[model samples]
Target: MSADILTFRPAPLSQADAARRRAMLLHPSNFVPASAPDRDATEKAEEQAGRFDALYKEFLDRGLSANGARTEVARAAAREIWDGFAVQLRQHRAAGQQMDANVLAVALASIQCLNSVLPRRPEDPHHAVRAVSTARRRLQYNGGLLHRLHPHRNPAFQDAVATLQSLEVFLTRPQQHAA
Candidate 1:
């Protein structure tokens, strides 16, 4: 024997109910005023985000919006950072010293990219996130290799790894987007 099951499906809304719903969705302010504390918190949140968007081009030498020139500039910045790390990597190998300096550079690059390089967004929306993602990808790719080298617990090496991990966390975090 099969058991019969019945589910409560909401009936189609009446015309008056549908119109009221549309009005409610269209005019939120008509129902309630924004509270002062809520308004103040929203303002503060907005203030903290994109404070330097106007200066993204000034800092990075490219506009916030996508352009061939802007993409090139970002790639160039990553290349320069990589070149610096590469020189250090070669020096350590040639001089027969531990890979201390090169590892340090990796960590420093991660922090610098997060703090300085990526903040130069040409536009306020996803621009900063995209720029930071570029930097984060480069840093993590190299840093992953460095992590595998087993630096024998050198404090500086450990510190650099810690910093890079922290930056990765920041980049992966969910950010508040605009309404």
Candidate 2:
């Protein structure tokens, strides 16, 4: 068989425009998942989870021993991370969709992130206690809600329950606060 060859034309974008397009595509606000609510929820959740992980690492790797300026910066970073997560959650709920894989993914990532942040009690006992308690509350809200949903249908709930228990252990460990 004889075939005619055709030249293909490609559309070109300016460097600045291309950069902007790439940024928009990568922006968390526009992230879309394969599934409904779940995809968006999962992406948003996981993104926040990563932020949590960063904060945890920062705290663990560089405790309050860091200079006051550095500590302030880290504290601001942590606050921003948490604030972003809270905003995403509110937006998801406001959208009025049944929670799905995306939401679950977010919840799972959140649990993992919080776990990573929990400090060992013997070191900075005061901060460790506070971090554990905060993580426990978040785990309770994230895990408890997911667990209560069709308990018989999902075995994964058990893992979430375990995560919750781990957080609780961190919260309740005995520590005499420094005077």
Candidate 3:
């Protein structure tokens, strides 16, 4: 025998309820009004606007949406940060701070790429995989570059790459446990 499931029915909304809904939707608290200073700041904002011009060109070249270009901009910013970290690794070596420099570079690159993604679409499995791939590539290329710069083909370079491999395994675990 199948049991019948009864669900509760909500009463029809009255005119007052409709009005309240409209009021809530249009509430001032839901929107911040721009002040005169805000307007002035935008009008006279120092030239960051010019930066987006090439971004538009990049989008046109790639036949991508503005949003896609914006995402690429975030990824590029991470790469730039990793480049700066590469310089720091050299400084650390000169100072006799002797942990594997490439390892440090891998960690920094992984962190940068992970942090770089904006408006993350974690619900999309493909996007999550893509993020992991980007991180892995950054770590791999940085390690390769560091190895090329080494004077004597030391084992430390191999160890550094191994460290990055461990990180990649840690990073690419099945997404179900990721959350």
Superposed by TM-score, candidate 3 places the C-alpha of residue 54 at a distance from the truth, in angstroms, of 45
Sorted on TM-score, best first, the list reads: 3, 1, 2
Tell me the spans in candidate 2 whose CA falls farther than 4 Å from its real position: 1-100, 112-122, 144-153, 174-179
Point to the candidate with the largest TM-score: 3
- CA RMSD of each candidate after superposition: 19.0, 17.1, 23.1
**Candidate 1 residues 138-177, lDDT tens each?**
5544455555445333344333333333323332334322
- State how far residue 101 of model 1 sits from its true place (Å): 8.1
lDDT of each: 0.45, 0.43, 0.48
Measured with C-alpha atoms, the lDDT of residue 124 in candidate 1 is 35
Q: What TM-score, over all chains together, does every model reach?
A: 0.31, 0.28, 0.31
Candidate 2 lDDT over 96-152, as tens digits, reads: 634644454555465444434532223343454355446545544555444443342
Tell me the deviation in Å of residue 90 in model 2: 26
Candidate 3: minimum summed lDDT over ten consecutive residues — where? 170-179
